[model samples]
Target: MRTQSVLVYDGDCAFCTTCVNFAERRLRPRCESTPWQFADLAALGVTQQRAEYEVLWVTPAGRVHGGAQGVAKLLLSAGKGWAVLGALLTVPPVRWVARGVYRLVADHRDRMPGGTPACALPAHLRPSAESPATAD
Candidate 1:
């Protein structure tokens, strides 16, 4: 069997969580799912600050994927119909299109569900003075 990868995503973002939940239901039987957290990201060699700025995925081969590419990879690994989607996403033009869409969604995420400042950083877990600001 192919080695499964670790998916890293924002646990607080409702939209993100919803999508992950869907993926989990469809992919869980095949792969591993891991919530994106400061410690887990750090251990994966990805800075918490970086992960906070975007979604990430760590392939079993130690390769890292982010954004639409990450999602495509996850679906592809999930087996069945998504596998075809993943394969198609790897094509040059399709890959470009996929990334572009991912960028649009990510850029406008603040307007999407579970995108409020409170959701991004709940009062109880606000960033400390030492934490790095969001990446540009």
Candidate 2:
């Protein structure tokens, strides 16, 4: 088993990097946060395509959580007040809403503060349940 969980994200996206920086600075979650470009996805049991599409939380045991679920896992590891918010996020009904919120934020990230056009995934790279993040 791996010794630590890893948080993987898109370093190329300014918005994404800023968010990660905020999480690291403020949330202080106890995990190794790395840009997917620098991570060994195969070793983390994460696929390059999936890493390109969404943020990921790769557990020490090799289980992978994506998008909003991954954020919840990250929060859970942060301890104290963060764990409470994380627990709330995992509640079934709340999780569904969180997923939608995450998707919306992802879709418009290019327009967010600190973001560049590079932060927006082309429609072709958007997430879908059937094929992960494949386009229509």
Candidate 3:
């Protein structure tokens, strides 16, 4: 059985890898970060499509939070100023805005520093093309 939460990200994206590295070095979030391509998605109860779409936080109990919520959960686990920020991100209006901001950044990640064209989500995997429930 799992103990710590697993942070699943797109390892194929250099920008994503860079962000994860920064989080590890600076934020020190309490989780094991792994690229989805290298993870056992089935064991983590994550789908390939979903993993490809956004960052994922998979709790030991099997709860899966994606995108901005995933980021919030990661921060919450950090247990400090980051936890405070994570709490703020979960507030109704703040959560909504964070979701939008996360999407905006994710949509343009391919243009971000260290990012490559491979960082862009495929058409079928885009949020507009596939809903969360159907992503799997």
Candidate 4:
């Protein structure tokens, strides 16, 4: 069994929506995902700005994980070969690189799979891609 978590993502982005659908079919984590625009952010301790900028995992216990870490937790909870990849991504050097890559892809996501020019979050909503600190 899996503990419930809310996987908050950008519903308006086609790339993000397709990625969520991919996870739904492949990872099959127990979490229920929603666009932050519709989910109750206050109840989850997630800021709308943050949700707009990155993936968020909020557990029933109120534990919050954001960005790549959030994706990692979701994969591990899914219980499959995917967990191994998720675990590896959490290791030190790989974790560092993974976060960087995640940010890079996020910044260029309008060019990613299923992405469209209009799939991007507004400029104000996008964190400074140069500063990892800002994304957190």
Best-fitting candidate, measured by lDDT? 3
Q: Which pairs of residues collide in candidate 4?
A: none
Enumerate residue pairs that collide in model 1: none
Query: Which tens-of-lDDT digit does each residue in 1-136 have in candidate 1?
Result: 2276777777666667777888777565255666665336655767666566677777767788888878888878878887898888878999999999888877666577656554446323644323444544
RMSD of 2: 6.8
lDDT (0 to 1) per candidate:
0.70, 0.87, 0.90, 0.84
lDDT of 4 by residue, 1-136 (tens): 2267889998778898899999999889888999886898988887888888899989889888888888888888888798988898799998998899989988898999899776675834444233555555
Segments in model 1 whose C-alpha atoms lie over 4 Å from true places: 1-3, 27-29, 113-136
Candidate with more favorable, higher lDDT: 1 or 4 = 4
RMSD to the hidden true structure, all candidates: 5.4, 6.8, 6.6, 7.5
Ranking by TM-score: 3, 2, 4, 1
Q: What TM-score does each of the candidates earn?
A: 0.75, 0.86, 0.87, 0.85
User: Would you list the rank order by lDDT, best first?
Assistant: 3, 2, 4, 1
Query: For this target, which candidate reaches the highest TM-score against the unseen true structure?
Result: 3
TM-score of 3: 0.87
TM-score for predicted model 1 compared with the true structure: 0.75
- Measured with C-alpha atoms, the lDDT of residue 99 in candidate 2 is 94
TM-score head-to-head 2 vs 3, winner: 3
| Model 1 C-alpha lDDT versus the unseen true structure | 0.70
lDDT of 3 at 52: 88
Over 25-68, each residue of candidate 2 has an lDDT whose tens digit, in order, gives: 99999999999888988989888889987999998999999999
